[model samples]
Target: MNAPTAVTRSQTADAVTVILFGAAALVVTAISTVLRILGTFRDQGIAWSIPIDEQPIDATVDSGAASVEGIAQEAMVFAAGVDPVSTAAIIGSLALWALAPLIVIVCVMVVAWNLLRGRFFVRGNARAFDAIGWTLVLAPVLIVLLENVGLNGVTAAMGLETEGPVHPIEFWSIVPLFATGVAVGLIAAAFRQGIRLQRENAVLEHDTRGLV
Candidate 1:
C-alpha cells in the first residue's frame, strides 16, 4: 500500500487543527453568552445571593467620636438592591464582556482556516498571530478600563460614593495574561522563519523534479 503523500499529510493536520480550534471556539462562545444573560438578570435584581459577601462598618463621625482605626478599617457594603443599573450601562457592560470571548474565538478560527489553505503563507499567519497576541494582551487592560469606567458611572448615577479605590487592578492575575500574549507574538516570529524555510525547500524540490 502506498503511504500518504505530503499534501495528504498537510491536509490531515490542517483538518485536525480546524476541528480542535473550531470546537473550542463554539463551546466558549456558548458558555459566555449564557453567563452574560444570567449576569444581566442578576444585575437587574434577580436571585444573586449565591455570591454575597457582606461586611459591617460603623460610621461614628457624626457623633463626634470618630476613631482613626475604626474609620480606616471600615468595610462598606454597597448594594444595588432593587435599583437596576441604567439600561445603557448594562448593555454596554454585557457587550464588552461578550466581545472578549468572541474576539478570541474568531482569532483562533482564522489561524485554523489559514492552515487549511495548505500554503503556509507567512503574511496570513503573521496577521493571525498578531491579532491573537494583541487580543490576549489587551484583554486585561480593556477589562480594567471598562470596570473602572462602569463603576464610576454607575456609582455616580446612583448618588453613591465608593469608600476605597474602585476597580483596583489584580496585578498577580494579569501578569500571566500579558506574558501569554508576548509569548504568542514571539511564537509568530518563529513560525515566520519556519514557513520561509519550508517554502524554499518546496521550491528546490520542484526544480530538482524538473531537472530530472
Candidate 2:
C-alpha cells in the first residue's frame, strides 16, 4: 500500500484503539465497583492483611448480625469517612487506576498522531514513549501500593480485625505482578524504538522524494 494510505489506516486504527479501550476501561471499572459493593454485603467480613504461614479464617464477621439495613448503614459510615477532599483524591486515583490501560492506549494513539502530523523524528514521541514506559512500569506498583494503603487505612478506621490466622496470598503472586509490569515496560521500549525507526524512515523518504 501507498504511504498515505498506510498512514490513514494507522490513524484509523489508533483512533479505534483509543475509543474501544477507553470505553472498555470505563465499563469494566463500573462493573468492578458494582461487584465490590455487592461483595461487601456478604456475610463474611473483609480481611485486611494476612499473617505468615497460616490459613485465613473468618474473624470479625457474624452472619447473624449482618442485615441488608446494616450493610446500608455501614456504607453510609464508610462514605462519611471519605470527606470531600479525600473523596476527590480517592475518586481521582481510582479513575486513574481503572483507566490505566486507557492511558497506555492514549499514549500510543498520540504517538501515531504525531507520526502522521510529521512531528519531530526523535523528540515527537519522547514524551509519549516516556509516558507509556512509565505507565506500564508503575501501573501495577501504584495499584498494589494504593490497595495496601487503602486497606490498612480502612481497617484501622473501621476497627476491622480478622479473628483467625490470616495468610494473605503468598508473596509469589506479587512477584508475577511486578514481573508483568516490567515486561510491559520492555514492550513499550520496543515500541518506542519502532517509532523512532519509522520517524527516521519517513524523514529519509521525504528527502528522497525531494531529490527525485
Candidate 3:
C-alpha cells in the first residue's frame, strides 16, 4: 500500500479547519447578538410574578351561624416594564447596538484579509478568494444579530413568560453567549485550515511540475 501523501493530509486538515472556524464564527455572532438583546430586556425590569393563594375566611352572623366565603384570584402575574436607565449605561448600550454591525464587518474583513494575504487555499487567485471568504462570513453574522435584537425587544414589550426554572428571556440571553464563543473558535479554525491547505497545494504543485 502506498504511504499517505503530505498533500492529502494537508488538504484535509485545511478544509476541516476552515469549515470549523467558519461555522464557529457564524454561530458565535448569532448567539451573542441574541443573548445581548435578551439580557437588555431582563435588565429593563421585565419579570414574572406568581400569585399567592388567598386564605379562606368565615363570617359569623348574630345568630352565631358561620358562612363560608370564597374569592378567586389570578394564579400568576407577569410584570413587564422598562428599567430605569442610567445615562451612562443607556448610552453605552445604544453605542454597543450601533457598533454591532461594525463588529461583524470586522470579522469578515479579517477573513478577507487572511485570504488575500495568501493564507487560504487559493492558487494564483489570492485576492478573489479572500474577498469571497470575507463576504460569506459577514452577511450571516449581521442578519442573525439584527434579527435577534429585534425579536428580543418585541418579546420584552409583549410581557411573555414561561412557567419553568429558566425564563425564556434569560435563556435567550445567556445561551447565546456560549454559542457565540463556540462560533468564534470554529471560524478561527477554518482560517487556520485554509492557510494550511494553501501551503500544501503549493508544495504539491511544485513537486508535480518538477516530476513532469
Candidate 4:
C-alpha cells in the first residue's frame, strides 16, 4: 500500500548481508564435498555409503567381510572399484548438492536485495521464489534417485547380490523437501498476487515522483 520505510530497507540490507554469509558457508561445504568425491575417484574412498536393509542390525564392516552390530535402522556398505554408472551417479549427486542450495540462496538474495532497494512485489522476485520452491521439490527426489542408481550399480560391479528390489520410492527422502517446497510455493504464489495488486500502484507512484 505504501513505500517501504528507510528502517525497513536498512533491516532488509542487514538480512541480505547475513544471507550472503550463509551462502558463502554453503559454498565452502560444496567445495568440501567435491574434494571428497575427488579423493574417491583417486581410489581413496570418500566414505561413500549406500543403504543396506531396513531391519535393525549390529555390524563392523571391513574390506568385504562385515561383522554386524545394531546402528539404528540403516547399515553401511563399504565399496571400491566403483563402476562407470556409479561414478556418473556420484557426480550427479554432487552437482545436485552444490546447485540446489546455490539456487535457493541466490533467489533469496535477489528478493532481499530488491527489498533493500525499497522495491517489493516485483515479478522477478516471484520467479525467484518459484525457482526456490521447485528446486526444493525436485532436487531431493532426484538426488535419492541418482544415489540409488549408483548403489545398485556399485553392488552389481562388485558381484554382490542384493536382498530385494531397491528402486522403490524413497518416501523418507522426499517428505522433508516436499514439505519445504510446498511452503515456499505458497509464498511464491502470494508474491505473485502481491505483484498483480501493486504493479500499477508502483507505476503511478513512480510517475508522480519522477523516480525510476
lDDT of each: 0.60, 0.53, 0.47, 0.74
lDDT of 2 by residue, 66-97 (tens): 43322111222241242343334344446556
Superposed model 2: Cα runs more than 4 Å off: 1-22, 34-96, 105-132, 158-172, 202-212
lDDT of 4 at 42: 54
What does the lDDT come to for candidate 2?
Answer: 0.53
Off by over 4 Å in 3: 1-86, 105-172
Per-residue lDDT over 48-105 for candidate 1, one digit per residue giving the tens place of the 0 to 100 score: 2111234444455657666332323322223353234443444555666677667666
- On the 0 to 100 scale, the lDDT of residue 90 in model 1 is 47
Clashes of each: 0, 1, 12, 8
Best by TM-score: 4
Q: Give the higher-TM-score candidate: 1 or 4.
A: 4
TM-score of 1: 0.60
lDDT of 3 by residue, 1-212 (tens): 11123344555566556646656766776777676555544644433223345766555566877665666343322235433332233334434544554455455545444443434443223333333444345433543453344334434445543232223454444455445545665655565576567577778988999999
Candidate 1 has which clashing residue pairs, if any? Answer: none
Q: Which stretches of candidate 1 lie over 4 Å from their true place?
A: 1-14, 17-21, 27-31, 34-38, 41-93, 163-169, 197-212
- Tens digit per residue, CA lDDT, model 4, 1-212: 54554646568768778678867877786887778666555544434555555666565778648686564644445566777777788789888887888888788888877777676777778899899999999999888877777777667655776424445566685898889998999998998888777867767887989964
Question: How many steric clashes does model 1 contain?
Answer: 0
What ranking of all candidate models by lDDT puts the best one first? Answer: 4, 1, 2, 3
